[model samples]
Target: MAGGNFMGRVVSYVVNELLVNTLANSPAFQRFAVRTSKRIEDASNLAARKRQELQEQLNDSLRKFEDMSQKKH
Candidate 1:
């Protein structure tokens, strides 16, 4: 029947895609991708911490300058 053929093609397509995806995400591929992602996350966190430290330093300097200006006046 036409319905049976349609169902068979659909099932075939689904199984093929699943197999291809599984191969693509095998252990070696997964390990490299996961490691790369973790490195990127670590880099981002380091940059964020550095930015916060810089901002704190700037704010402290501004406060000291403001106090010095008030003393002069």
Candidate 2:
């Protein structure tokens, strides 16, 4: 059982190394990685902008409500 476990680990390591080398050497994989990274970055930036816009809008609404309350008082 110990020998079987050792062999399984060795096989897994070799298969992982082979896959890493193949993907590292492949031009198509490199291009896909770059495009995917750029898309993720763009999405992150857009979400940040949207979050800021929403915060600003909420602040404006709060200010208007405060102004209206002051007028009633």
Index of the highest-TM-score prediction: 2
The clash count of every prediction, one per candidate, is 0, 0
Per residue, candidate 1 scores C-alpha lDDT tens digits across 1-73 of 9999999999999999999899787998789889999999999999999999999999999999999999999
lDDT of 2 by residue, 1-73 (tens): 9999999999999999999999999999999999999999999999999999999999999999999999999
Clashing pairs in 2: none
Candidate 1 residue runs with Cα over 4 Å from true position:
1-23
| lDDT of candidate model 1 versus the reference | 0.96
* lDDT of all predictions: 0.96, 1.00
* Per-candidate alpha-carbon RMSD to the true structure: 5.1, 0.6
TM-score, candidate 2, is: 0.96
